[model samples]
Target: MFPPGFFDRADPSPDHFFYAPPRLVTHIDDQAIAAVGVLYQELGMTGEVLDLMSSWISHFTDPPERLVALGMNQVELAANPQAHEWLIHDLNHTPRLPFDDNSFDAVTCCVSVDYLTQPIEVFTDVARVLRPGGLFVVTFSNRCFPTKAIRGWLYSDDASHLEIVKRYFEAADGWAEPVTKQCIPPGIPGDPLYAVYATAL
Candidate 1:
């Protein structure tokens, strides 16, 4: 388990307040976005996909059959052309997902895991939603809103960040050995992208 106050954010303000404006902006640069798309292609994310804590741009160059976006702002999600459906929810306040068990073939949280306050519970729920052999992919870049990012993420480097996400998978059941990948090649001028993924056992 993480140490006390590990999940505390610098800004204690409600997440809805910060996200209410519906900023339809891409968090990472084009290079990082392309890297994310390549990572998704490697994962073979073709079936139903749930984009948790997603924004307007999911970074999925090859869109899935059915895409659902869940996040804090409705306008941003609405702007997502790839998403067939959208839901507004605050994971920090309610980690429980609003979906049936084994509902999706894949679950992805893009550039937003650091904002989660209850990661273990959320990860378990992610596992529950995935079918057998289904995967959960989490991708992140160097950039983020510092005030909303948790203390654990704010203080950690790129390697430690991967370890933290791996531990989240370990803490939950029904997950295979997590595979970590460097989406962008080394010494990139754009944001450094990384991913940690695991399949349902």
Candidate 2:
């Protein structure tokens, strides 16, 4: 749990305005991006997958049978070659997901978890949409749009960011114990990658 102002952002404008323009850039470096793909492969991320808060790239070395991307920018979602289906949806505005229960085998949010103002609600919905024992992988690095990130995320360090995401799954109360990992080795790269993931109960 966090304080009242924890979710507030420096830029209080609607997320649509903030993400209106398509920025087709990779937030993390090549090494960090590779680490993300490796993690997905290690976790056996296949079947129907939901890429939440996605952008122009899913970063999958081997994409799943079906990949659905949901984000705020249509152009970016459309540009994702790995995505089998894509939609423009704002999680901050509406935490409820449009998919039916048990629709996905796995869900991923890459490098964009900090922007979620209603993370717990979104996480709960993610759980609802996932089948039992489905994995929900959340990966992130230090890079972020500072003005759009939550106050708590902006104020926290790397270790605290892991704890914050772990607590999010806990608060949602529909996941198994979350596992945190340093995807990219420390002190050897452009941007350090971290992950906090759990399986839906």
Candidate 3:
């Protein structure tokens, strides 16, 4: 079980209040973004892909067939060139996805996993959407809006953050052993990158 106040944020304000205005900025630096792209390519994330908590750029060099980018901001999703279709959705408000079961080959959340108030529930929905053998990749950086990040995320270090995400996958069904790895490009002096991913069973 999770600790008390695990999901609470410093700013207990509504998520919609903070996300009302669209931010078209990139969260991680170029090298970090490239590292993420390399990881995606290495994992062979193809076919119908779902980008959860996505932004303007997916960092995907070769786009998938049906790339669905879902996020809170409409403008951010609208600006995404790789997304065949983008939807405005709030995971905190509703952890369940609108898609039918086993709809995607891969699902990725880039540098935005810390904000989830209901991570386990969201991960369960991720399992529901992913086809068997599909990947659920959740990547994050050392940076975040401290006020918006959950208490567990804000209080934990990078290693602990990976464990937290790993636990989320373990708490849900239809997932194989989660893989935790560093995505920071070697010799790149910038934001640290990390990922915890698993394959749907």
Candidate 4:
């Protein structure tokens, strides 16, 4: 068995919940969406980017030359206007990625980091696929499928969740200094979302 806190085992069978669902909705609200744009602005535009764990939409404001998406559902990825190419795969089943070393200029995982059961290995692979000085970005909100979210995530606070993603960057050996951003839209009437980012070491 995996370590106690490494993953939430109560929802061990996410495929059962994931396979049949098709939520054609954006997880974050308008304010949060704008906040993502602001975050992406800081990331800078004009390079190849990989949208890891992407869905029906990618909140990237500035268009890049190439945007690739790797997701669980092809329909969702196809619906994403920003993705030029998409691959369907479950990272929980295979933490390894199929891309060559230093393939992407940047990587973005949006709103789906809480579902990972094998984050460390995935983070390591992300580091391997990114070019030197390239970036890895992870964004998440307070919304998730309750039955599918892991037990650890279900009980954790917003601060702890940010720390969890930060730790993923830290545990990945080749990541440069990682920065965590709190996406607290001022005077917003909803759950708080956060973004954590890092550059390749």
Instruction: Name the candidate that leads on TM-score.
Output: 2
Which pairs clash in the backbone of model 3? none
Residue 168 in candidate 3, Cα distance off native in Å: 0.7
Question: 1-201, model 1: which lDDT tens digit per residue?
Answer: 899999999998888999989787788888888988888897899899999999888888799999999999988998999999999999888888999998999999989999988999999899889999998999998788999999999999898999999999999877889988888745878789999999987
What are the per-residue Cα lDDT tens digits for candidate 2 across 119-184? Answer: 999999999999999999999999999999999999999999999999999999689999999887
* lDDT (Cα, tens digit) per residue for candidate 3, span 1-201: 898999999898878899989999999888889888988999999999999999899999788888999998999899999999999899998999999999999999998899999988999989999999999999889989889999998889888998999999999877999999988833568988899999999
Considering summed lDDT, which 10 consecutive residues are worst modelled in model 2? 182-191
TM-score of 1: 0.97
Model 2 clashing residue pairs (backbone)? none
The candidate maximizing lDDT is 2
Q: Tell me how candidate 1 scores on lDDT.
A: 0.90
lDDT of 4 by residue, 1-201 (tens): 224765765557756356546667888888787777778877794599998888888887886799998888767878888889998888888989999999999998888888888888999999999999998889888898776677777788788888888988888779877899887733568756699999997
Superior candidate under lDDT, 2 versus 3: 2
Candidate 1 or 3, higher lDDT? 3
On TM-score, who's better, 2 or 4?
2
For model 3, the stretches where C-alpha displacement exceeds 4 angstroms are 185-188
Each candidate structure's count of clashing pairs:
0, 0, 0, 0
Q: Which residue pairs overlap in candidate 4's backbone?
A: none
TM-score per candidate: 0.97, 0.98, 0.97, 0.92
